[model samples]
Target: MKLQYWGTAAAEGLPAIFCRCETCQKARERGGKNIRTRPNAMIDGVLKIDFNADTYQQSMKYGVDLTDLKYLLVTHTHSDHFYPNDINMRRQGFANYCGNKTMLTVYGSDKVMASILPMAEAKSMAGLLQGVLVQPMEKVQIDKYTVYPVRGVHAAAAGPLVYAITDGEKTLLYCHDSGPLPDEVFAYWKENGLRFDYVSMDCTSGCSPMDYDAHMNLERNIAMRDRLLAEGLADGKTVFCCNHFSHNGAHSLYDEFVEIAAKEGFITSYDGMEVEI
Candidate 1:
């Protein structure tokens, strides 16, 4: 599986729009990997993880053909990750490209459906957009992959989710915007004998202290990695990536973050980064 990270920042992004903090200032000074947009990723150019606000910019920057995208898996209704308004652009008058014939199926929780269904139903999006409500732990088949979503620790009311996907040969665990998951989630993975080839985790808090349960910090990610290895959920060959950064994080500048993450055996994800496993 080829997984590409289109954007690797949290909601505010690196070098946040209005902030002038040290981290943001350094991020502005150090472009390249330090420059990040909201969180979003794609697998093999067909399945997208989120419809971030920066989708347009990411598409242009990476030369991605957004119209050709077939499947979308949303984590939650957070505007940074799930921008339902843009999905409307695929409608008749807005887009008349040949790629429009490819139906885009979005899978997410009921809250995700609630957010997009209203707008999608407002018009005749008939063949353009389709929303599927994905329940926790229920396997959903998407083309060549079997996707299993587990409820996340964030946004209880929104029914947030993290996904585990496998295409028979390789498996991926995409976890973000949440703190350490519940024990049951891990047990489910063990019970099903699902081992991951690639693991993408949230590092929103970066080098800062992880005082809350909403998002994870670097320490939490490291601990999670150890646990995954210890529990046989991931082997030494599994690629672990730290993603979803924030300007508020300390020592989160790309170079510094990469140096630290490399020592901890993690790939610090950058915008437009692609990895094959």
Candidate 2:
């Protein structure tokens, strides 16, 4: 399995759209890892996580052929995570795409389905759809992949979801757009002793010590990692990577995070970061 980090920024992205913060300023001056797009990822060119507004730019930047995607797993209905209008591009007559009668399975929580349903209604392409299909949460098997939808703790209105995806040999925990693990999720992990080969967690707050309602700071992330290790949820074989960083987190460069997380046994994810498992 191959995991590619398409975008690694929080809501506004590094060098944020409007602000002139020091971090954004530095990111503008120095590109590379400092540059970030909205949050999204691709797994083995089959499963995609989150459809942020920056999807187009991410595809162009990484040379991703979106037509080949088999599944789109949405975390929530946040503007930065799920952009409904952009998805319409995959419909007929919008963009020149390939794939024979390609059926794109989109999975998410109830709110995500609600958000996507209206768009399909307005466009009236929901009937003649050749490339997309929206599937609500359940343990669904699509294109040789088994995905488990877990409740996510985030916006009450959005009703978020996190995923545990398994493509036979390896399992990945696509945990973002969420806060601390809920008791049920913890119990599931505890009872099953299910270990993830790859973990892409939420580190939107970066190095802040402040507590956030739906995001994790660097300190919280480290503590969470320690807890995971102590509970046998993670081991040396598990590759832990952090993403969804905000410009407000203070650190401007991705290398800085790599250096910091290295001391604590985490791989800091940046745009275009890829790992083969």
Best by TM-score: 1
Per-candidate RMSD vs. true structure? 1.3, 2.8
Off by over 4 Å in 2: 96-99, 118-138
Model 1 spans > 4 angstroms off: 98-100
Candidate 2 clash figure, as a count? 0
All candidates: TM-score:
0.96, 0.89
lDDT of 2 by residue, 2-62 (tens): 8898988888888789989878888888888888888888888778888988998888888
Q: Rate the local accuracy (lDDT) of all candidates.
A: 0.88, 0.76
Error of 1 at 196 (Å): 0.8
Ten-residue region with minimum lDDT total, candidate 2: 127-136
In model 2, which residue pairs have backbone atoms overlapping below 3 Å?
none
Extract clashing residue pairs from model 1.
Answer: none
RMSD in angstroms between candidate 2 and the native structure over all alpha carbons: 2.8
Among these predicted structures, which one has the highest lDDT? 1
